[model samples]
Target: MQLTIWSALILYFCVFLAGLVDSAAGGGGLISLPAYLFTGLNTHTAIGCNKFSAACGTGFSAMRFFKNGALDWKIAFISAICSFISSFIGIKIAFKINPEVLKTVLIIILPVVAAALLLKKNFGVENRVEEISKAKAFRFAAYTGLAVGFYDGLMGPGTGTIAIIVFSACMKYDLKTASGNAKILNLASNYASLIVAVLNGSVIYRIAIPAAICGIMGNYLGAGLALKKGAAFIRPIMVIVICLLFAKLFYDLFARYFLGG
Candidate 1:
């Protein structure tokens, strides 16, 4: 597809915003996916291209969070390695399934995700002692990695938010720690998908590089604010963004498949 100067520039502008939302919460794909679709790319190419672009921004955010001592590398490394393996399997499975099945499922998924977000305030930012054993913790980490990573490669919605929610609810991680760790795992899953995108040549480097720069800047800004204001601020944003993302997903599916507009 040929790109007009205006279209290219504007799309990159949107990617920057996507990165900001991604760093602060999750589901940034809500923005970047539509931008790629507007370029007339097919679903596969659009998703692959988005993975390539957003992975860079996610990496920057993960690094920032790590530097600030917000992450638990013990868990992050375990989950990341497992996630990478699971995502590879997931992409392959996605190729066989009807994409609309996933879309319809998401219509059912969003409202629940939204409700979960609403209840997130009860989760709290304070750290809790691990009630599970080391063996059990490692087991949970691996399962979460595989499940979420598969979702990342296959559908790419609510990945970060899901990770944070699990970290808190299951692992007893506080909100800030969960967000920080989730960003790292999110980077891993995005990178897993990007490898395939690069192989298939769906990504345009010209668009990706500038957008990545903007995304990195946004991460810096968002992470700075997250660090300052604490999870109380980030938590509300996570809930709202997830709800918005769910609505966007529902609308996209409804228009393309149901309304046929």
Candidate 2:
């Protein structure tokens, strides 16, 4: 789709900010996706275009994390493979069902995720990264990436926050390791979904390029901050972002399902 002068500028800025927020918390799509829809692109095309720029943002973040010594390559490798394959399945699931139902589910689940973070007063206090029996960690990482990756491929929100939380709190990974792994898995999902979008011919390159540049800049700053500040910073932001995103989703659902607008 062709972009107007105003829309192109806004799209670029939106992507850049999305990348920043996404790096900081995880729901960058909360901004970019709706802006795309508001600009008159269909939801499917907006989501596809989102993946295009998100891929670059995520790749940049992952590399930055790696350079800063925040990543664990062994787990990232397994997660990338599993998340990529599962993301394809998520794309298939999207076609098989109406996402309206999923939107409803988000209203409930979003609050729970938010509460989980808000309730925890001091998150990531100590580094308690366990030496997982290689097989078990791989198994858990596989499930986490596979499930979250598929959700990302299908719906396109909250993937990064979920990844960080699961890895750090649930899997007992250090904040650094979790962020590193999250960046890689997020990128993998982007690859899978971008292919899906391309196959379906939904990409809007005019917006994608500008948005991606913005996203890269935003994420670069965010990743650096994450490395320096730790998960405590990310946790609160994730809570607020999910709350806002859910509110928007609910409003969209109301408009679409009831108001017929």
Candidate 3:
């Protein structure tokens, strides 16, 4: 498809916003994917191009996390490896399973998740990693990567948000650290999905390349903010991302089952 001037602007602007939110919280695809579809791309092409730009943006954030000492290298590496491998398998399973089923489940679960976040005022406020054993943290990280990565491959939204929550709740890292580590796992999964998109010849480089630049800028700024503000900043953004994902999934289910669109 030809990249019209208007389309390019729309893609860049939305992708920049997506990168910012995604870097801080993890549901950037909720914004970017709609923007691509709004620009008249088919679903497959939109997803492919989104992956390309997201991978690029996520890489920068992941590096920033690493440099700033926010990440647990061992946990990040273990999760990345597990997610990278399982994501491939998830992709294969996608062809066989209907993603709508998963969406239905998420719609129900998101509210409880959101309520927990809202009611628990001190949820991710402090870094509690000292309390957890090294072995237990690593185990949780691996399980998070495998389970969430598989979901990412199969359904493809809210991966980072879920990862951050799991890291904080289970591993007891603060929100900032969780967000940083989640970026590493996200980067791995993004690359895995991008490879499949590339192999299918679905990525539109003309659009993805320029959009990726915006993504990088957004990610750089967003990561900086998260680092500076710590959990106070990341927590609200995560809640917003979860709410948006919930709305998106609810709408899809509504459109499919009720509206018949």
Candidate 4:
């Protein structure tokens, strides 16, 4: 499968954009995967390569967050393991079902989430430091990991955003820390999914390599910006990512129903 130079350029450009947005907010796969498919690869291969690039991007951001002391190791580690295991299971389930059902539901929910964010001006801005028991925090982290990880494997978007929201609302963390934690957990899911894709021979390393390089740079820069700017930077990007996810879902629905693809 030889890719034309134009296709390679387009894929690199798309992955670069996806990485930047995903590092700052989440939902980068919303762009990266579609870009892969646009290159005319089979869905499985596209998904596999998407995981490759996405994982690299997330891993870079996670490291930056860790270096900056934004992560809670206990929460991040537990969630990472759970995300990996659950994502593996989710991928298995996804193979058996029609993803359109999930897409339709997301299309409905994304707007509601965006509206909620818009309505609450200071939603992800400040850390509402509530002293909860260690046991409870662990439980919350585990539950969030399993649920969002499952979603990531099954549908492959918004997992990080969901994790960030859970951290902010449930764990009482600030948006910056929440974003950092989300990046680590999200990497686990991407790794699990990428492993599956590799075993199934779904990844195209030729394309994935270049895209991953672009993704790494984007993640590095985006994470740095997030650390510097805080939620003031991440909030609007998160909203925009949600809206893009909505648009992607809408397009998919139209393709499936209207075009009968």
Candidate 5:
């Protein structure tokens, strides 16, 4: 589909916002997926195009985190490998499933996660010592990769948030480190999904190219802010993203099941 000037401009703005939020906290797909759908693409095509822009943004953020030495290469690498494989499988399954079913599941799940974060005041605020051995951390990281990566590929939203939540809560990493490491694994998941999208001819490059450029800029800026401000800056945005995800999922459910829009 060809993009008019107004559509292209709107997409740029939306993707930029997504990149910023995704880089700082996660759930950037909440913005980008809806924006793509508004362009009249079907769910699969919209998801494919979204992965293109989101992956670009995530790549930029991961680079910044790597440069700062905030990422644990050992964990990130293992997680990334697991994420790639799980994401590929998830995308394959997504091709056969109705997205409404996924939205229904998220509606039930996201609020609980948001509530948990809200109730735990000290969560991800500071770096915590590893509560388990290296072998255990590696095992936990692998599990996180498979679970969150599969979710990312199938639903294309809130995967990064899940990663951060697991990394900090289960792996005992600090928020900064968790966020940074999440970017790396998130990139892997996005790339894995993107490959499937490309093979299935779901992406529209005309829209994706400009949106990706805008997304890259936003990621760069957001990652910079997170690095400078630490968890204090990231935590609030994470909360906001979670709330937004919940709201978006609720709307999708209501529209499809009731309003039928």
Candidate 6:
């Protein structure tokens, strides 16, 4: 797409916000993808560019988490490896299945998840990793990675947010730690998708490069805030991301099943 200066500014601004939200919680694609489509790029090109920027932004936040000692290296690596492999299988499955089925399921599930988070006041406030056996934690991480990664490849939205929820709820980590862990998982899937986008010659480097710079800045700052504020800061953002994902899914289902768009 040939972007005018105004369109470029708007895209960059949106990407910066996406990086901020994604680094703190997840679901930044809800913002970044729409921004790209609004700029008149086709769906494929928009996805390619968004992946390029998101991968770069996520890398910076992951590094920050590592440096801050918020990440469990063993769990992160295990999940990353599992997700990396399983995503290929998920992609294969996507070709044969109707994505609308998954979307409908998510539409029902998201609200329940959000309500649980809201009602359980102390949901992710405290890190309780010590209560769990190491073996059990690792096993759960692997399972989470496989399931979430597959969902990512199949439906391609809200993957990161789902990862965070699984890490916090199932593994009993604080929200901050869960957010940290989610970054590694996101990085694995993002780069995997990015490579395919590149091979297809879909990425527009002229646009992606500048947007990536903005994304990096946003991620850096957002990660800093999450590191400083802990679970209290991350929890609300996670809820917001979940709501955004719910809205997006509902819209897609409506457009396809009802509007015939």
Report lDDT (Cα) of residue 86, candidate 6: 78
Better of 4 and 5 by lDDT: 4
Global fold similarity of model 6 (TM-score): 0.97
Estimate, for each residue in 1-261, the C-alpha lDDT of model 2 and write its tens digit.
677888877877888888888886678888888778878899789888888888889889888988988877878878888899999898888878888787898888878877866787656555566755777888888888888888887776788877877888767776666878888888898899899788989987877777888889988988888888877677777777888878877886787668767
- The 10 consecutive residues of candidate 5 with the worst lDDT sum are 252-261
Which run of 10 residues does model 2 get worst, by summed lDDT?
A: 123-132
Give the clashing residue pairs of candidate 1, or none: none
Lowest summed lDDT over 10 consecutive residues: which window, candidate 3? Answer: 252-261
**C-alpha lDDT score of every prediction, in listed order:** 0.79, 0.81, 0.91, 0.88, 0.86, 0.90
What's the C-alpha lDDT at position 35 in model 3? Answer: 94
Please give the RMSD to the true structure for each candidate, in Å.
2.2, 2.1, 1.1, 1.6, 1.9, 1.2
Question: For candidate 5, what is the TM-score?
Answer: 0.92
Candidate 4, lDDT over the whole model: 0.88
Please say which candidate is ahead in lDDT: 2 or 4.
Answer: 4
Of 2 and 6, the candidate ahead on lDDT is 6
TM-score of each: 0.90, 0.90, 0.97, 0.94, 0.92, 0.97
Model 5 C-alpha lDDT per residue in residues 18-45, reported as the tens digit of each score:
9998998888998888888887788879
Judging by lDDT against the true structure, name the best candidate.
3
Models ranked on lDDT: 3, 6, 4, 5, 2, 1
Q: Candidates ranked by TM-score, best first?
A: 3, 6, 4, 5, 2, 1
Task: Identify the superior model by lDDT, candidate 3 or candidate 5.
Answer: 3
Q: How does candidate 3 score on lDDT?
A: 0.91
Off by over 4 Å in 1: 99-106, 256-261
Q: Which lDDT tens digits does candidate 3 get at residues 1-261?
A: 787898889889999999999998899999999998988999999999999999999999989989999988899889999999899999999999888899999999999999999899998888889898888888888999998889889988999999999999999888889998899999999899999999999998988898899999999999999999988888888889999999888888787778667
